[model samples]
Target: MSSRPAPPSPPRPISVAELDLDAPDGNVLSLRPAPGGPAVVAGDVYALVRLRGRPAATVIGTVAAGEDPAEVLGALARERLVAAGPRGDAERLAARSRPVSAGPPPRTSVVVATRERPEQLARALDSLLVQDHPDFEIVVVDNAPRTTGTRDLVTRKYADRVRYVREDTPGLAVAHNAGLAAADGPVLAFTDDDVIADPHWLTALTAPFTADPGLGCVTGLILPARLATPAQILLESHGGFAKGFAPRLYDPAEPPADEPLFPFTAGSFGSGANMAFRTEALRKAGGFDPATGTGTPAKGGDDLYAFVAVLSAGFRLRYTAEALVWHHHRDTWQDLRNQAYGYGAGLTAYLTATLVRSPRLLPALLTRLPRGLAYARAMTAQRGEPADGGVPGEHGTHHHPWPRSLSRLERRGMLYGPIGYAKARVTARRHGRNPR
Candidate 1:
């Protein structure tokens, strides 16, 4: 007879916290509760370790029932943080992380697209209000909102500081375009309504554009704001937005050797939540496709499409670790399931949109399609020992073992992507709108 398989472990709650390795006490931990969540208590803990105010690493530990959450998490964080780097290195990074080549960062407009999530929007707005960058304006794009909550919050509380624009269209890309059209700054930065930005985020993100005039786009780091639930922890374990801690430049003129897919692998550059673009460059390439994003049949690929469009336009793209945000990931298991499928759908949808937008790149994409499909298979396969040996990822993605179910969902979504994009295009045409 065949041996019986082991049952899966029961799901448990986890607490989230932040620790600064360079703090005066060097052991103080700031515990942050998830949105609408209860207070932190002793249990599994997830902490974002910072050195000199810059995110360095993340560590997961357990706080026994009777143990103090702070002390337990702080000690584990300190040990792992040391492995990240010594204090001197943190100091140097801090010293060098100034306004790059600056008289001052260029005047920029920050765009936040949302749909009826008032409380979360408030948190993000609060953080944005404190950004250290000197000249910047905030624009909130209400995307097919069902209620006036977003408008009321922006008007009642932040009437003076933020500009409100309404995009009746349902897609995230459409809302972004509405904000882009309303913005007056030379640099346009886009972020979601579910993030807490660092004080220097704008400066670090926009400064590169000034330092390198040829640069058309820049993306920054996104760390989890909370890992309070099983879904959040599991997602972060395999690198939620894991783009390494180092800075890089993606120039179309000089494609990277390691990336076999080059610009087609645009998702590798960075995520949309922490990306900025030059106003002229984005307009020239045409803003995000209206049919591709959340709330559309495409289900998401707007950001990926934009990244490739910028690169294909012969502009350089930069990825900076210095600019950072804390993203509040979806909390429930069901939400994770939806996200997995949606990600799969979005990726292929973005590829479809890319080909539709510029047919010239189809040949290059076709050449890589075979390898790309194989790579996708491996990515969605059940996670066991990592392909990169058994070493833990410095970016904190290897903490929890992954389930094959989520992988399967992503693959299913990939299969449906091209079909979804077709439906979305058909709908757009029926509505007498050109998504391009």
Candidate 2:
């Protein structure tokens, strides 16, 4: 045995390339080793190697060979692949490797507002049921359904786990309110039918609330489910749902300064698809506006309105990037165009409603109008340009071009928004539905 020493192990392969971590629409690049690569896992350390005249490459600390390549890359990236430095390298590695302790997580009620998409709802439920967080319940609000399909599916497949409710009212806000009424948990979370949440989503979302009793709302990050189609890429280029990769806390005492649009630009706070709120705080804000949202005349802006209300009521809101969700984008070109139109209409309507409800804020809003218009023009001009090469960056400012017709449609929607909002208000009044 001593005469014939064992042969040395083969050297592991190192992969060095620029990772486009932040594509315009929140899509990460798909990088994988050629074949027979090393295994990659979460909490693995990597060094950023910089060479002259070349993009930086990641010197992988672990070879995650023969596994799902995309999964490995994503895990490494999320764990923050950073360059080695003089400051406390050992401590960082230990912190990353430490297992998260399990404790009694707060009970949360997750609301899924769906209209006609049973297939997508099913997929969303599948992901929700398997969440690693222990204490949670699912409330599926079938909003103005033409058929009993969603109810029947939920009863048959998830009766033990999910509570199915039929909200005859036709609006995302209405459906959300219905869910709020039905939920029993102290914390209520909302997500769309088209998103698949990460296993740690609930834990990440609720942790901030526990740490700060005054925290009223928490919004998570939304990444694209896939980027195989052109429309998906374009939508992402136009600034996807991701606010930013960094965690942010908005203290009511120290509101953001120098922003042209403060509360009116509430969409920047976070998206509706992956947001949670304290039940009592949301009720105090009067729930979501029934005149807004997908099924209403305003076509959207309910989430933005809610954000503004929460902030105006003097509660803190936070954006936690770790609470992740993958949203399936509209696959067709026409759908994408319609979505763009909806966004403009929704935003304008949100501002209009704000002015109607709170006249005192008008002075500030007027001051911001010129700057807002300028920003909109800049956005229009940046359309169709190539995105910044997959480098990690801020969200909500990227501009990808839609067809000329689509752009025109969005502008038209913006012009019509105030009128539409007026009509919606009248309709809501008629129905005795005033979602403040």
Candidate 3:
């Protein structure tokens, strides 16, 4: 039997809270639980500050045992949010009040891919069923199940509200592809089984498609569902999955000046946890690459591959912070270590998949290779003095340094990416599916 040493003791847990700056009263804000998280408590708190129901910023605050958490967090939120100035709040409210178009939002199919985590799946499904979207359907893709837990849950609990599909193949891409095959609506949105989506998520995600005929993909903001653990705090402190509050449209016709790598800088585009696609565009681009993503030797990259694929097909990608989902991050150091390896592996594997599947993009990738390499170094480098170079952190910028050990694991994953991808491709072939 093999013995693995346990990690050191973790830090004090920080409770996750949601602070709406636009609460009925000015400073009389009530700190609420993050979706799927516990109630507000006096200790360290990580809050998602929303101004007028829009995610304004995330700020950290502390409250003594005797002090009220809401009061403490409210003061911190007001002070920090004020720093954003009055114009910012006005614009956010304006944007919210502004309509996308005269017509209704597109009909949508939301895909929730899962495996053995029935509890998480159920929580995610409950959130999805309550979406404010005018028209939508939920499809639960049970990926490579070890038992019928997911099937039973969907059939018994969400029979009428949610549709259930199963993929015997284990890979995340394969599972998503299964959902992709079953998706009926013109617009398809994909979120993980561990998420608690905002009520307006589906509406916000699909609205762009109806408003912008040329847009192919839409991705949204992802905030930590829970920050009650050190690993989660560490990850969120480094940006977690939340992209900034700024809405961006990446039109291949004209790349942004800030991104020299353009479409290839897909990670910055958005994450898989909160992404949607124009059904026809994704189908035309060949759906997701089965050789990538979790559950495969590739560790990850399924989402990244699809992002690049859709973009390369000459369609634009939009990112709106308005469409949000709360994600439950891995809570332990080992999980973090695994994530680091997966992230690194998935990056390279997706890059490899992109080139192999769409050979023409190889030239563009080659031209940007040098700069990409430089960026990778900066990303895996230490924190600040060395940083992950990930999305800007809460309230803006990081609070903790990236660990050198995790960085090394990530680098090793990058090295194994191509090999792992190749292995996954072979596995797919043996299983009677097309990996390419």
lDDT of 3: 0.82
Encode model 3's per-residue lDDT on 1-436: one tens digit a residue: 9988654445467777788765322553446888767778778777777766766566777788889887887887666545445756645544553445636778899998999999999999999999989989999999989999999999999888899998998999999999989989999999999999999888887888888898999999998887666677778766577777778999999989999998787899999999999999999899999999999999999999999999989999999888889998997878998998999999999999999899999889999999999888777764232112222232221223457777788899999999999999999888887865
lDDT of each: 0.80, 0.69, 0.82
Cα distance off (Å), candidate 3, residue 75: 2.6
* Model 1 pairs whose backbones collide: 237-397
Candidate ordering by lDDT (highest first)? 3, 1, 2
Candidate 2 residue spans exceeding 4 A from truth? 1-104, 258-260, 383-405
Q: Give one digit per residue, the lDDT tens place, for model 1 in 1-436.
A: 9988665553465666665655522655465553334566777666665655665556677787788776776776665544456877645544543335656789999999999899999999998999999999999999988999999999999989999999887888888888999999999999999998878899889988887888899999887777656677677766687575667999999999999988888778999899999998898889888879898899999999999998888889999888888899998889988998998999999999999999999999999999898878877785333221111222222224676778888999999999999998887677655876
**Per-residue lDDT tens digits of candidate 2, residues 243-361?**
75446778667867855466666877899999999998898877887788888888888898888878777889998666777788787677887887898888888778777776777
Candidate 3 has its poorest 10 consecutive residues by lDDT at: 386-395
- Residue 109: error of model 3 in Å? 0.8
Q: What's the C-alpha lDDT at position 260 in model 2?
A: 46
Clashes of each: 1, 10, 3
Cα error, residue 179 of model 3, in Å, equals 0.6
- lDDT for position 167 in model 2: 92
Point to the candidate with the largest lDDT.
3
